[model samples]
Target chain A: MHTAGVTLQQVAQQAGVSLATASRVLHGSGSRTVGEELRRRVEAAAQELRYVSNAPAQALARATSDVVGLIVHDVADPYFGAIAAGAMRAAREQRLMVMIAATFREPGLELEYLRSLRAQRARAVILAGSGTADADATARLAEEIAGFEADGGRVVCVGERGPDLDTVVMANRGGGGLAARGLWDLGHRRIGVVSGPAELLTVRHRLDGARRALRSLGAPLAPDAVTVGDFTREGGRVAAVRLLRARPDLTAVLVLNDVMAAGALAGLRDDLGLAVPDRVSVVGFDDVPFAADLRPALSTVRLPLEAAGEAAVRLLLEPSGDEPRRVALAAELVLRDSTATTVG
Target chain B: MHTAGVTLQQVAQQAGVSLATASRVLHGSGSRTVGEELRRRVEAAAQELRYVSNAPAQALARATSDVVGLIVHDVADPYFGAIAAGAMRAAREQRLMVMIAATFREPGLELEYLRSLRAQRARAVILAGSGTADADATARLAEEIAGFEADGGRVVCVGERGPDLDTVVMANRGGGGLAARGLWDLGHRRIGVVSGPAELLTVRHRLDGARRALRSLGAPLAPDAVTVGDFTREGGRVAAVRLLRARPDLTAVLVLNDVMAAGALAGLRDDLGLAVPDRVSVVGFDDVPFAADLRPALSTVRLPLEAAGEAAVRLLLEPSGDEPRRVALAAELVLRDSTATTVG
Candidate 1:
């Protein structure tokens, strides 16, 4: 700060402005209360004088608890890790520390993390909904956020939305529909679906989109067309095994996430002796780094997870709740070598 | 805590012991204060009453932020996430919050995190060294730890140890030596080394073992035998390209980590058109989860990363001296499909 060689008083003198005006302009936090013309004049003076803010004061004022909390199902999965990186970047920008806890897809852990976040007095909690078999998770998400709010805690739910809570989510349903439509357009009549935790809102929404897409193509999905998994590789294998067995004639599958896609790929090629794309086209969600590197590069949806994390931070720090509404960001499809036109 | 259904006071009174002993037994903090006979009585009563400790009293006594600070390179890396999980379990046992920060391998951001830890008044700061290129990051690490201590902060470092601080690290060199021995015993010669950042202690140790193994075998390793990469998939690709191009006659390649191993697999199979185990054998470090799932399972060394993280937490919680002794955890080499009897 001293290295700037120009002080606030110098800026005030340079612009023929008052010391208070210069202080307000040079320091952004206080500038909000200053008049526009006076603020501009003070800023011009500071620019002319090459003035710098005091590091000690700036740091002290900006220094928060430095703790941001992330609630997730499993930290071991690469998809969660990718989202965590985004949250980390956001925390770094806000000069905040991050604490991540794995619920292991347990609703109990989700509640435990929320309570701990309250006790630690974290700046915000980003909840990636639990991957589980319970149908009430989405219905309960609002109540969960409400309880946290009652305890004077801030909640930012990613991939889920609830009343009175800040939510940053990807447009998952649209992405799912897009994936289904992409395959449907390729003349595939029998398309199978692999889904995440049956109870999760994302899983439900994605299934809805897939079913809708099938309906649009004049071919409604069968009751047994979709099989649910717990979002782990093992789960993917189990789901794929059953799906393939039930419908050996199925030509394409849209797996819930890329990790599951990897599992599906291995299960098909190695376990079942089926060739990718040629026999069964496989597509996945969440274009994790390894997706492109997989043997027949996986086709997947790239969720802007980092941006969602950043948006959550922005929302938490500058909450504009006069008319708070949920924001839905889009997830784009990234096509690679995973999908090939199917032939009967 | 409320759901325990048994009260500490009742358990103490029933066991004919004082409240402190029962509390200590229940909390598992401050070693067993009750004597053998008395401890037995307390345990018997506690079991009879199914007693549990409330969070309030513990929060009051150890209330001034019982948080263990963790700063790592990437949350997306499965190894670090495993480490974080282990550390969190330890923290939960001790009833503490684990504050985390991801540095993205930026020293400037790391400094900011270190300062943030101090400002937040964390109980201990645990730094998990992330990248390999940081040879002297420890020197810089020491300065930050010193500054935190000067500000009355406690720091415990994992993975990387230094002259000035308390540390918990895995035996990288020993593990590396064993890996080389594994390959040697398997009759593989003319081995190639693909290591992490050459400046890292782990990389240096692994490289030394490879050299020693080759030299002791009475085989002079060609200078062209060693290649250094950034411990990334892309880095592996680039390094593999150069090494394979230079030495088409090489029999095997040793990779520093599993992520890089997957990349080396791609480069050999897809880019370089070489058959694994037949043309060149590949081995990696960390034995991450995905290693076993890859087409040809990876051969790797398993390091107890989680234990290291927990050990660091332990050291940080307790005031240890400046002796700076290394805690050498045991590691084993896991052999799988990636290596064969050097079929020529």
Candidate 2:
């Protein structure tokens, strides 16, 4: 019956061909040859029967699959959306199916997904989520990656998963420096930072770079000037309010990411009733799609996020060398209407 | 040896258990039972050997997989991102892994992905992309869907795909009417529409509703007032510019989606030197995450995108009935600063 999936025997019988010939024409499993006319007959019969080869069975026989796994922290975040799009495009070019798994920024979920993807025998697993600051979690993730690799699956990390692994490193620290230097060059002395969770490597690197730049400028970021929040818009809004409430004299604020920067803009303009640039300047990082459309047109660091995603997939598909390969992408500053010269 | 994947025989030997016992303990296959102590030993042995159960093999034996496939028109679009996030959340609660595939709105790619998912033996498939207006393509998709169902897999369509399939229908027509009536009540008669490709079912239903409402109000949408473009920001920008150049007397514009609407706002404000609401009003649909954050705050129709995504997964998981089930979610109007009374 059709409910049980059409059998290859029926297709072969209908096409008046041998089972081996039908299998070769449809599944292309063995190195076998069939006449052109017979091949067409088998194909026509298979189409008539709506026959779909069992991929799982084929994978079991070959010990590999045509599926690639993309692991992200959150699917809803536009940051990940752009990256996933690039990765999927590259995957399509290779005629491989990309299966995305979102971790929701939970370390446990990330590991669980890694294990699941490994067990599913995905040919390659792209870890696009940021690395965690927790040492134990990092070690466990490294172990999982090792297990995946040991099982003949390739692993590509987007943002510093660990040492000795194929990675596409984004210039997070350099972007942070650029944001701080840009604000400092505009003559803003008293500045605060809206930071995401301290456990994320992205947050740490960005904050560290900004701190170094400000220190070099002879105005170290004060301990009280940094307010940590979730890596979300609401988090940015709330943190901006708290930072400003505590440091009312601060002339500018640097948000760790664009989404938070958007919230910071709303917080400064709507919640605090302050005029942007004239009273308080705001800078964001990772110029996302809507960054240019915000009220003041967010001035942030431009990271070629989509390109980085494409690069990750490329590295994964490339031949593995004795040592893991590294591809670093640069981040540049984008000046928009969001930042301006400070006024007394 | 590890690259070849740890074998069940090795694990059984390490655990001092029989092959059948190890298979049941690790893969949960067959009805054979093992003692509690022996089960723990087998699990520990498998962990020690780093043995990952071959999912493809297990799926072949069980005739299903724990993986569910989600097909979308585009992964980078925030509208789909929101829905995917909701579906993933619901899937996690049910202990199922979700594999998302983006078609990039290509009819051929959509059909190809459906076939691929079916070949992978995905337990269920959630078709989140909008149906096309092409009858031949629709028929092919329907035939492929029937093949998948015949293989004992579940199918859930997020939008109006076909009759006799579980569908979560959004109030596209009603929302279109609401958008038109809302603009009409503001005394805007010469309204232009920045529409997406007319081949899309979503575009047709929304336009149909708007036209019906306008006709009843004694003011039908002029054919010359509609400018169709790609379902993207640039498309909206170019469409808005073209529409306005042709009919400079128009005071309001209706954009099909928020991303394009964002572009329309820029096209009108920056390119055309028109102030939002003051010079011309704009209305958008979908009310994506950044709609409220956009400059001037977009006024649009709000669809329960995430909830709809969750509903699709729920429907797929539920026991199939003799007849297909339908779930319709309502869309409401959200008035923001983007719209105002028309200036005569």
Give me the TM-scores of chain B across the candidates: 0.79, 0.94
iRMS (Å) per candidate: 10.3, 2.4
Clashes of 2: 0
Q: Residue B89's C-alpha lDDT in candidate 2?
A: 92
For model 2, what is the alpha-carbon lDDT of residue A303? 89
Residue B340 displacement in candidate 1 (angstroms): 3.0
- Please write out the lDDT profile of model 1 over residues B218-288, one tens digit for every residue: 76568898787777898887788678899888888888888888888888888888998777888888887
**lDDT of candidate 1 vs native?**
0.73
Name the lDDT of candidate 2.
0.90
Model 2: fnat (fraction of native contacts): 0.74
* Residue A284 miss distance in model 2 (angstroms): 1.2
Candidate 1, A129-162: lDDT as tens digits: 5344465754465555565555445677777654
Evaluate every candidate with DockQ and list the scores: 0.17, 0.63
